[model samples]
Target: MMESQQEPKVTIPPLIPLEYSNRMMLKTILECGDDQIGLFGKTVVVGGWVKSSKEVKREPVAAALKPPTAAEAFPPSPGRKELSCVEVVQSRIPFFKKIIRVFGVSSDSYPGVREKFEPVPKPPPPPPSKFFLQISDASSISSLMVVIDSAVVPVSAGHVLPTGTCILAQGVLEKSSSHGKQTIELKVEKILHIGTVEPDTYPLSRKRLPLDSLRDYPHIRPRTTTVASITRICDTLDFAAHTFLHNHGFLHVQVPIITTIDSEGFSEKFQVTTSKKWGLGSGSDADVRHETVKAEQHIEARDKSKLGTGVKPEVKEDFFGRQSYLSVSGRLHLESYACALGNVYSFGPRFRAEKTGSIKQVAEMWVVEVEIAFSQLEDSMKCAEDCFKFLCKWILDHCPHDMKFVTKRIDKTIVHRLEYMMSISYERISYREAVDILRKVTDKTFETKLRWGVPLTAEHLSYLADDHYKRPVIIYDYPKAVKPFYVRLNDDGKTVAAFDMVVPKMGTVITGSQSEERLDMLSARMKEFDLSRDQYEWYQDLRKHGTVKHSGFRLGFDLMVLLMTTGLTDVRDVVPFPRTHGKANN
Candidate 1:
């Protein structure tokens, strides 16, 4: 009985060789040193799509091979034979080849494969004929290629597929000797539609559409190569800005968008209210009924006039018992936070109601407001320079592809320009010096003549950025009469410790200054500016309790985008759903 006991037989399958597996082979290829593969006499396999395909017949030559020329032989040749009939394959295609096997002479030689064929895989039924194929599969690396049946319907304006469609394709891959690279040509044995259609979708496609055309479709523009690339760059810049501050121990503060005061008193603000007429009335049933009656009466009176009239009948009762406006800037609030929390920054949308026809302005845009306690204008200027340099370097390093595309298409000198700006130390000069420089440039191109006390115009700033400094210039110590009341008065009494950082294309990207921390001086300045003391009681309370010398700056986020990518013509082009005066499409 013991001898009758027997074990079941087991069979083990043979292991697949690493060289035959696609992933293993791809790893090997990636690990291979550059130039290790000869230009000829090497067998290489590449996976991509057929950008274009052609068939031609020629008589096969029977002549013997000739000796290499001196030009070709100067570089000691790695022993390999060159292949004939080089082909080109565009890498822009998506999901070129999920899997491919190419055997050819000379890994560097193109059209090396004497014959090309793709192994067909069983694929699902084709989608509707209307459905276009968009392939995106990774062989081993993260590279994805997309191949569309361009012959069926050439991708053009209004006919391109919405972005975000997934597709599968079968194709042949070969090395292109003419182009000096490898490519995949989708013989397209079978195209499989693996996903449902998305309404608005796109990844990389043809050239960037104009900003004017994209304005009509803000939500979908991001799907395009240009917009996507810019978005990614903007995101990186934002990250760099925050990181530059955070790494230096600055607290990230989220300031309120709705506030009672305008930090930049020069610009008009969008009013926010809780009154029934302004759309934020809610209370008890009885109060609601009363509000409804008042609203109806007001509406009846208003309807008696023009249909598009913006005025509303004045109500005696206060809404929310206080007046508020969409903050034009968060600098004031951030100053208080900075005094309390050391150094702080606020990043958020700021709204303005000014009808600026100038190309430099937008009604609603994001801003980066930074305030540092115990810091002066000089310290703030240094911080700004460091922040700008950090942003440029971060974008170049983190968003190489996007930056490259933007530099090539949007602005040819963007990278070089930004690099030069970062490498060179910023020039610092007094406002008086800036005024003198502007006075010297008396050309017809200048829109306005420069005056000593007048606020510097965009033309003047442009001259400083483009001509005078050749880089970012920090112009400080402005005339106190033209500056905000918050700015600290300099020893000269006629000037304030304020500065504006002007870049080549964008002027006044950042404006900041040391605050008047001395209560007596601030009170006197507030009186001189004709500002109501009651309006800033809380702000003054800081001085009453514990006020420290501080300096801060406000950077228009849209302006930063324009300066970074150099594509956007106006601030509106950079912001999504822009709310410029006379145009509130969102």
Candidate 2:
């Protein structure tokens, strides 16, 4: 056997910093200094939508711009008197101090300094010098004031830069201590671009609009403060989730969105079809199948009992040579990878043929599914809890301002809820105990009555998390009748090693279980669930081969955001262009 040669390792350079060679974000400029003092005299290019603009007609006061000073130079410049006003624009700070000469001062040394100072002539007041327009780049909750000079820039401030108008400009930043508020104001020397919006038709013309009304303009909903804050929170939460998963030695695997197997066979699936009949293409076999379908268009004479035979010519014409649907979950696919990779996860959109128009239910949603090899129900719960807690902490650390704004305007107890979840461990109980607690509840009446064999409703989940435990609670060992066949059968024989993590306001945020690894036990469960054994040949092959005990869970990413953000009540509000039952226009 020949020995393999070792390849040389390549060294990668560090990433180049992007402090705006082309353009800078408002966030970078806003946080550049101690109260923005660091931005004095530094020129930058910035772009954003105009939140507010006003034409300020004020008389030019050079004294306000320049401070008075009395100091004598041994040799005063001849243009010192003429350059007094010009120096104010050049230097922000005053350069002279009043020094009284007690000793006899020489005439040559005090040539410019005299007992009585010459009065500087007041210059004529200039025309409406500039208009102040406030703009924000959606990167931060705060806005920067742009001092637009009409003579310098051709764009009309009042008409061209309305509430929803967008613009890009390059200018020098000057310190503005207006009304004792120390802030940085961009002195607009050039206007790069202007995106004007008609004031009469603009929906966000007002300073504040009702949250419900903003839902109508889904395209521009992110322009609002509430939506922008929610967006930042959601983005950070996404990164936080990825960070937690990567840190825990879980390999992220991409699962197919278009799948043949219905991982969760219990739910209705959205059928994937094409423009052609039976989803057939223009191949020779497709042509024959098309002719056969046309010939059997009317089956009134055919025996109805023969319909049980699925060997119809049209079935072969179907896409993938079998019926396929959008994946409702990635559990089965993740498990296949988990068995090989030891631990794996998949994060992507999962579609459901959901007709329910509830605030929490949507046709399409993003899910984070994880599978841990050589693990059981407890391992799944532990991983879920750690990931959940890390997400909450990440949001709190990264988006403190947004969270505060949300708390003051949306939900006041958001911070408390997150802190409570992080400070305490999630309570764990079995399905039977959860049912018992629900049965003993006397304060509130639930719409769905408590039953041992039936699935828990939103009401039951809420009661357990909010009222019973007053925190997040994990309920495990669900009844076999309620859980899917993939879940492992517990020793009790009546329940499965399945679990659900219920959050305070979000209800069930995560649900997972130890997969049935034993071939005979899995086959028995499949038989009991009335699932087709032939269709899951590959799944069964795993159990027949090197299948070890493995477990995993699925978390609704949107619901987790709602729980972390606290104020958001609907999952649609957090998701951009939410595809609900009747609302997919945008």
| After superposition, candidate 1 runs with Cα above 4 Å error | 1-143, 146-208, 278-319, 442-445
**TM-score for each of the candidates:** 0.66, 0.79
Model 1, residue 531: what's the lDDT? Answer: 75
Task: Report lDDT (Cα) of residue 98, candidate 1.
Answer: 22
Weakest 10 consecutive residues of candidate 1 by summed lDDT: 48-57
What lDDT, from 0 to 1, does candidate 2 have? 0.80
| Model 1 TM-score, 2 decimals | 0.66
Candidate with maximal TM-score? 2
Task: Give the true-structure RMSD of model 2.
Answer: 17.2
Model 2: CA > 4 A from native: 1-21, 33-35, 58-129, 180-182, 277-313
Per-residue alpha-carbon lDDT of candidate 1 for residues 285-363, written as tens digits (9 for 90 to 100)? 7887788888878878766774577654453345644667898878888888888889899899888787778776777
